[model samples]
Target: MTKEEREQIATCIREEIETLRETVARLEDSAKTVDLDQPIGRLSRMDSLTNQGISGKVLAESKRRLLGLERALANVDDEDFGHCEECGEPIPVRRLLIMPEASLCVDCAE
Candidate 1:
C-alpha cells in the first residue's frame, strides 16, 4: 500500500478501536446477570436472561476484535503492515481500510 493509504488505514483503525471500546463497555453492563429476585414474571425473567446471554456473546466478540485492532494499530508502521501473512502478497487497500486488523488477503482468508 502507499504511505497515504497506510496512514488512512491507521486513522480508521484508531477510530474503530475507540468505537469498539465504547461498545464493549456498554455490552459489559448489559451482560451482567439479571436479578432473579426482582418482582417480575417468570417469563420476563427468562427473557432478561436470554438477552443477557446474547449481550455476553457480543461482548466477547467485541473484545476479541478490539484486541486485534490494537495489535494492527501497533504494527501499522511496520514494513509488512499490509502483507498477507499466509500468501506473502500485498493485501488490498480497500480491505485494509474496512478491516485494518485483517492479516490475510481475501483469497487466503477464504
Candidate 2:
C-alpha cells in the first residue's frame, strides 16, 4: 500500500484502540461498583462480574490487535509496511485493506 494509505489505516487503528480502552475502563469501573454481599446483590454481582470478565477478555484481544497495528505503523516508518515479515514478499493490498495489522501473508498465516 501507499504511504498515505498506511498512515490513514494507522490513524484509524489508533482511534479504535482508544475507544476500546475507554470501554474497558468503564466496564471495569462498573464491575467494581457492584456490591456482592447483599441478598440479591450476590447474584447480580455475579452476573455483572461475568459480563465484565468477558468484556475484559475482549479488551485484551483488542489491545493485542492495537499492538500489532503499532508494529505495522513502525514497519511503515521503516519502509517495510506492505511486505510480509516472514517471506519478504509484497502482501496483497486486499488483505492489507481488510487487516492493516497483518504481519504475515495468507500462506504464512495458514
Q: Residue 110 CA error for candidate 2 (Å)?
A: 1.2
Among all windows of ten consecutive residues in candidate 1, which has the lowest summed lDDT? 27-36
Model 1 C-alpha lDDT per residue in residues 25-53, reported as the tens digit of each score = 88877665467788999899899988888
Runs in model 2 with CA error above 4 Å?
35-40
Q: How good is model 1 by TM-score? A: 0.95
Provide C-alpha RMSD values for all models, in order. 1.1, 2.5
lDDT per residue (tens digit) for residues 3-77 in model 2: 777777777666666776777677667657666665666667678778877877876786677677676656665
Runs of candidate 1 with Cα error greater than 4 angstroms are none
Candidate whose TM-score is highest: 1
The best candidate by lDDT is 1
Query: Any idea what lDDT model 1 has?
Result: 0.92
Which clashing pairs does model 2 show? Answer: none
